[model samples]
Target: MCTSSVCNHTPKPFALHKSSSVEEYLEKNKQWSQSITNETPNLFSDYNSKGQQPHTLFIGCGDSRYNESIFNVKPGEIFGLQTVGNNLNLNDETIISTLEFTVLVLGIEKIAIVGHTDCGAVNACFDDSVYETLPKNLKNYLKPVYENIKKIKDVHKDDIPPIDKKQLSLENVKEQAKKLLSVDFIKEKFENNTLQILPMIYNVENGLVETIDL
Candidate 1:
């Protein structure tokens, strides 16, 4: 029905459509894949023929904002393992297997444990309210990181002074790097200068990565 000037157009019946989020993602991915294929016809073929010879094992947080693009690395350049808080459990079979394969088989020479400023996981570790509200599995997963932070805080009880969440994020990166280096295989590689373990911090604000001494 039309009445006023604004209502001159006929009204269309409302119809339920597919989920916009899923549809949009699929559409965008389709277009992106097509564009890549058109721009570099042999990209995928080259990857298949050469296989993956990644030089770095980049362990970063699961946060979507942090990605391989941040390092300006092309596909197949880095084998990435993303976990919450960029945490790693050396005893976990999945992690151990991946590490072994990447180091021994793939011959990756560098392991970078990267954390970022204003990390939600780091904040949640110190915030009891948030920690209390997380799911049981997530809480268990993050428990080691929480305990590690607590230990760091305790060490700073004297004249060292307490640190904020950003500093804690850096400390978490260092702790995770230490854990990775403690593995016998990884330690052997390190002692022999076959492997390098780096603790890195990415500043989300400035898009700059700084290496931290472990």
Candidate 2:
């Protein structure tokens, strides 16, 4: 029987509101936090006192299944930058500012642009026959994905018959990796060997992560 307000059929409030589950969740988190502190007291204390030293910057999609925590990397290792689309804006001041800060201030050692299979953004850009109207801001935001599709379309115009959505999705990830290199901070890191930028694609159906070499 579903009891939450969001549930279809319910007569009582959710267990979270009726019971002390919220408190229990907080208590469990506190216990876990203490366990981490006990194991790595110095690093945790230093992290608290000196702020984050996350060396990897992960840029991925807004997909809920693309959980960054599931990367199997150690905690405090990644500085995540998620968006609706994985593409970075060359002209966006905020994105540029964050990039500068991540390199100059955070001293991030790696930059990874990750794209997952069956991404709605990539699908939208690939399928021109669909006429799902979008908001103005969303249209503007998806321009980069559209642009990448156009570039692929142009290059393979005579050879290929309108890129396949699935293949274009993979190519989009590779294209985004090259686009990432155009950033000044990323370029500097590439030149000095201080950072390694990689593009990766995750197969949602199979739960597999495949690295794309750019």
The alpha-carbon lDDT assigned to residue 25 of candidate 2 equals 76
Clashing pairs in 2: none
TM-score for all models, in order of appearance: 0.79, 0.72
Q: Pick the candidate with the highest TM-score.
A: 1
lDDT leader: 1
Ten contiguous residues with the weakest lDDT in model 1: 10-19
Q: Which residue segments of model 1 deviate by more than 4 Å?
A: 1-21, 34-41, 128-139, 159-161
Q: How many pairs of residues collide in each model?
A: 0, 0
lDDT of 1 by residue, 1-214 (tens): 6667556465644232355577777777788778777977787788746888899999998887786668877677899998878878777888889899999899999998899988887887666677667677755666766666667655545634557777888888888888887889999999999999988999998999999998
Give me the displacement of residue 2 in model 2, in angstroms.
19
